[model samples]
Target: MPLSLYLLAVAVFAMGTSEFMLAGLLPAIAPDLDVTVGAAGTLTSAFAIGLVVGAPLTAVLARALPGRWSLLGSLLLFTAAHAAGAVAPDLPVLLATRVVAALAYAGFLAVALTTAAALVPADRKGRALAVLLSGTTAATVAGVPAGAALGSALGWRAVFWAVAALCLPAALGILTGVPARRTPQDAAERPAVRAEFAQLRNPRLMAVMLLAALVNAATFAGFTYLAPVVTGTAGLEESWVPVVLVLFGAGSFTGVTAAGRLSDRHPGPVLATGGALLLLGWPALALLAHRPAALLALVFVQGALSFAVGSTLVTRVLYEAAAAPTLAGACATAALNLGAATGPLAAATTLDTPAGDLGPFWLSTLLALSALLLAAPLHPALRGTGRTDAPG
Candidate 1:
């Protein structure tokens, strides 16, 4: 609702763009660098690994920096990394640059969410977080497509250059728009990070984090290899790949919007229903993958259900954190990156089997169910607590 929230959204849009553009550019980058496609694809994996390592490390190390400062600094780091990637002469150099970019991405998200929480009334926390996350949805709609087009037209490095340009403006915008405030570690602040960690000893928060990771693993397992699935398994033409992906993006946008509204009213129910839907969606969609109409319908529904997980996941993690939401938010981000890295890697290994398409679906189904099952322990803790708060 606030103009500042929209600016934060734009900053996140830039970060998401840089993070996701690699998928489209991998072919171009591989050929240009004289490397195998699989090797070039490791750039994306490198970024995820960096994110997994950086999220908590940065949050802990930068605890003394103002939220506004932390966000701006992280964006600046993102810009620099993009610039480095654009100019790198070798594959190893480019891969290193990606790690830098991902660390910034992971760290910036932690700071951004903390800033969102501090920016509004407690009742609007869900909405504020939604506004921040809309950037990722927007990337699915706008950023990834634009990056793909740019890479196709000008070359993959050009895409990195474009991302760098976007990052500069975003970094500056954040520095200008966000108000200066005391650091989280200031004397005025409540419970330290250690205290937050202690409170996080709760089974509920831990279960939610695991669930979030597993849910993400399930989705990414299918999505990372989607081109193969659609063309080989679903029998769709290669040209249809982009079309289906665009539809998935549209579905993600739809889900994010609806989830934000529902979360404001009933966070637990929305998440519970979404998790169940997502668990059901994998098998249903896999079975229908060969039917054009059914596949299309399932694809859209799966996109919606898969993305809605974040709305509830963020809220639950923060609620469980009580007064020290930063650590919980950071930990959740780390868990998310862990899944992002693991899903594709694990799926790649499994999909090489004789069953091919069936492998990913079965693996994803198991992961999704495991993720949903984590909700059992968390259910009782959430009982009777409102969406914004939980007992410590």
Candidate 2:
């Protein structure tokens, strides 16, 4: 991969850390801001709302700019938002900063995906996306835990400061490394607004986007509440939660890497198998929550399956929407964020019921099964040519 792609990864790692580290910091934040844990949890939804609203808007606004400039501008805004968050004195201010940061996060990711695809040959787009997305996995593994520890030691505000500091190097890397011009072919191939809108009318592309949303919803529904589940239901100490998270992140990194290689030639099978694993994994997790050994093993497996499906789903959308790859990339970001926002809100509702913490697992299982059924018609064996948009 190119240095520019790796720089993109650096930027993504900063954003991903901001996105997920809030889960671990919510405990610290709630008390400081005089709010309930449930109220603090809404911060995650706020971030996702920014992503849903910002992706398409940024895609349109940045259409004329080179990828490098667009990415750099987004990072600058992201860093500024995090700086504001670090100093935020109240819940409302902090929540507002999160929305600002996430808007930049969404724009950066959409442009990065488009830029990654532009850098590689058509056949290698899946792998290129995998490389870019690996940064998120890396954040889950390293950044989240580190931020959690820092928050515990100093304060949650310190974590935001740390994220802000990291973005400086990432912005500098992009400025120095990425080219200012799109490749001539990519520039010429850029779609007009009409063509971009036309791609959304394709049923296959829409199905892929829906699948993307379902996959993210299933994963985040359970994942957003994992700390509570680990401490209360899984019978683990609070300290051990971070260790389990590291294992889950490791599995996600491995799964996405493997999926990237397979998705180029066998996206259908990869999606089908990943959905199946998730369907089985969630129920098993719910049933075995009391057994620490089983819970640990299942956490890793669930993370792997969820991310494998996610990577493959993005590849499928890009393929099906080849006429407007950049817009498709932005839509993919929006769809996944919509799921991210919805999943936690649904899980929050479940927590209000008698079912309690276990409710999220069941919710995840149902969503995973839905994704599997939707994927049924996408069998690789039935695909006559390798094209994603072919009629079933």
Report the number of the highest-lDDT candidate. 2
lDDT of candidate 2 over 1-392, digit per residue (tens): 78778888888888888888876777788899999766777888889889999998898788888888999999999999999999998989998999999899888888888888878887888899899989998988888878877887899899999999999999999998899877778668777878898877987678778888888988888887787777888778777777777877888888899988887777767776677878999999989988999988998898888889898888877777778866877877987898888887787778767767788888999888888787777554212145644222
> Which segments of model 2 are wrong by more than 4 Å?
183-186, 378-392
Tell me the lDDT of candidate 1.
0.74
For each candidate, what TM-score against the reference? 0.89, 0.95
In model 2, the Cα lDDT at residue 31 comes to 90
User: In candidate 2, residue 312 scores what lDDT?
Assistant: 82
Q: Model 1 — TM-score against the truth?
A: 0.89
- Per-model C-alpha lDDT, please? 0.74, 0.83
Give the residue spans of candidate 1 off by over 4 A.
30-41, 89-91, 183-187, 231-239, 291-293, 382-388
Deviation (Å) of 127 in candidate 1: 1.2
Q: Considering every candidate listed, which one attains the maximal TM-score?
A: 2
Candidate 2 at 209: error in angstroms?
0.4
